[model samples]
Target: MTATDGHGLRADAARNYERIVVAAGQAFEEAGSAVTLEEVARRAGVGVATVYRRFRNREQLIRAVFQHIVAAEIEPAMAVETDDPWRDLVSSLEATVEVLAGRKVVLAIARETRALDLESMRRFVATMDRPLRRAAEAGVVRPELVARDLAAVTIMALATVHPRDPGGADRKRYLALLIDGLRPAPTVLPPPSTPDVHGV
Candidate 1:
């Protein structure tokens, strides 16, 4: 093959790979991670073999899509700034829950990934911590409330709203309830479902 032909083939392959990752992320976000690889290939406008060649199995493709989400969506959201730290923390928490509501791939990553790149988790928690502490000092959440509660509340409030849900109403309704429920109780806070601060 000519050098020009070789360069074109390489470029095309790279494009195909990108297309597949993008398509897979979109599919997972919309339909959850169980959506078939064939559906991903079709949405990407490539043959099924192309997806399989890039990702040997459904699990690998789902992981790649989660990586894409971390890079593309979560990172940008984390960088968002606002003068109101309380608002910032609350909105980001809600957004995260909304983003992950039905995403089984992310949930799987949360449950299974042995060595998750949790740096983002740490930073996100720090961001939430400052505002949360400020709110607590102002008597919003109880003084005893820790940073983990923010993550716990966000996940528990939204995890039930999967892609199979009829609408976002339930998610929004309960998220608001959970947020307001944080008003300082006279007694100690109850134990949360997951102990780790990071939801994903």
Candidate 2:
């Protein structure tokens, strides 16, 4: 939000901005980028013009909502205190997935639209990189596991929590399986369903 005085937002403008951002954050979390500006404005109890004044376009509003969510939910999880890297890692993963469970569409749009270059997204990746490196170095997980891999695991695990499985039993089972696989223990994995079928 740009300040009219170049120092801080005026009292009313700040409140409007906060309301619109908060409303958009919830909308995106619930409906992702598919949520419209009018819906956001309605949720915020503001006029569409007010939302438009603060966010010039849909892309700008989406990015703002993403930034708000990262700051409110995801960044704080990064501070989860624990002595065990494995527990710390898994706890963070669980917490993150809980947040992302509602925002899959937004995440997909952000990635597929190449918004990875956004400063907020870049900061998220940089913050996650540290924990990923630590988990690998401490042998808490597979050595090759990366932050993006954790994201993939979250997606796969939470995909089961969608409307098709509203009770979330599948989500829980998938998450448990994912956690088991992450442990640094030797175990036999099921054979691939189709091994070299293409034989290319």
Clashing pairs in 1: none
lDDT of 2 by residue, 47-123 (tens): 99999888887777767766766777877886675667777777777777778776776666666655444477555
Scored against the true structure, residue 34 in model 1 reaches a CA lDDT of 70
- Candidate 1, residues 40-95: lDDT per residue as tens digits? 99999999999988889766775666566656655566556576645665676677
Who wins the TM-score comparison?
A: 2
> Which segments of candidate 1 are over 4 A away from where they belong?
1-17, 28-39, 46-50, 102-148, 162-167, 181-200
TM-score of each: 0.59, 0.71
User: Model 1, 182: alpha-carbon shift in Å?
Assistant: 4.2
Backbone collision tally, model 1: 0
- Candidate 2 global CA lDDT score: 0.71
Error of 1 at 37 (Å): 3.4
- CA-RMSD of model 2: 6.7
User: 68 in model 2: Cα distance from truth in Å?
Assistant: 1.9
